[model samples]
Target: MLRWLRQLFNTSPLEFDESWRPELVSGFQHWSLLSQAELDRMEMLVTRFMATIDWEAANGFELTEQIKVLIAAQASMLLLGLDLDGYDDVTSVIVHPANVRLRGNRPSGGGTFSSAPIVISGQAHYQGPVLLSWAAARRGARFPEHGHNVVYHEFAHRLDMLDGVTDGTPPLEDAAAMARWTAVCTAAYDEVRAQGSPVLRPYAGTNPAEFFAVATEVFFNQPHELCEHEPALYGELRSFYGQDPAARISRPRRHHQHG
Candidate 1:
């Protein structure tokens, strides 16, 4: 009916260019970690993301296809296992050449707020466009060791806001799952604030939303460290993300000589 008609008139399905695979592999470290099948699926998702969203460049920055592909790849990684539509509220992606300085109010002590400018790498607004710094996004994609991915961090926020709430919790399966998620996340969040955690960085202690975002970066980037240090938290992330990055990542074994 109408669906069929729309499909008939719509353009052909978007496909990732084979030539771009090399660039993607060289730029994104996590790209090499994915299997062939996962790469295929990722390519499709990236294509859909690129086609659906309106890409914009800020401050006289030119929006290149490579940039679009790289950003879309990272953002699509978050939705690999989820079933919801890809950022339905996000209509545009605004990319800046470098870090953006935003004018806002900051606490100046003595229970006073003062006007100031804050430099940020990325930001995701509810029911609005996502803002990103191209330099930070590219660097984060290349170096997973940093555990600071602007694309993952902002897209994670978008996922958290899917249910009209900015809380750390996203849509869960059932009451039991929700209960477990809340318990594990609450305990971990408290621990992050109280004494700090080795696996999770200090930024996670900022808030529940930030905790989810920062945890996601570690979950995907530093999976081995996260699994070793925070097994429970890692388990929850694995259950929710439906992916075991630690298993996907290939590590060499050291042979010990007999004493």
Candidate 2:
């Protein structure tokens, strides 16, 4: 009864404008892969996401509706199969026009930390905002073959931090699932660190948290490659995300000729 009342009283999702669909489709390459039904759901999710989050622009960059929609669409894709609030901890999204350089402490050979300026494309803060480079995000959306998506990578980190832990594992069904996730992720992570994986990038080997984020980028962008190289890891992600991108992607057919 209370749940029903809450549903009735809660603010409805913003009405998504169909006119914007063309712009979104042109901006994001993956949009063509989604079915009509999936596109409808994504529109709703993106509307909700854009309405819920606070947006800001840095480095004198202009924040436009198109930028917000594109980012929201990519971020919402992660939550499509899950039954949770859309990035509850992500209160703000700070976007830069391009790569931002920041001074950070780096570990030296010894136990000392050195301060240096590091360039970053995107960053997800625990219990804070998501920082992104607009250029990188746009490029990533257009080119999935590159196996890099700033929006997916940073949002994946936010998902990893949902359980108050950033150890690469998100909230799961039970202990058994957690164990399996840990085992498979650990093995793949080790492979990336030791001999480099064909599917995952070298940056994924930085840490367990990064592994999860980078793996997510590859999972969504290059599903066929991920499934082929890291079947166990792909299975874990598929089970968790409840989406089969591999099946959705249609491969090109070769023509046979007879003389």
What's the TM-score of every candidate structure? 0.89, 0.90
- TM-score of the candidate numbered 2? 0.90
Candidate 1 residues 1-259, lDDT tens each?
Answer: 1435334423566767777677788998888888888888888878777767778999999999899989989999998877743665786899999999988787655688978888899999998899999999999999887667899999999989988998899888999999999999999999989998877888898889999999998888888888877889999999998889889877722222111
Error of 2 at 54 (Å): 0.5
Candidate 2's displacement at residue 35, Å, is 2.2
Candidate 2 runs further than 4 Å off: 1-10, 104-112, 252-259
| Residue 122 of model 1, lDDT score | 96
Angstrom error of the Cα, residue 164, model 1: value is 0.5
Best by TM-score: 2
Pairs that collide in candidate 2 are none
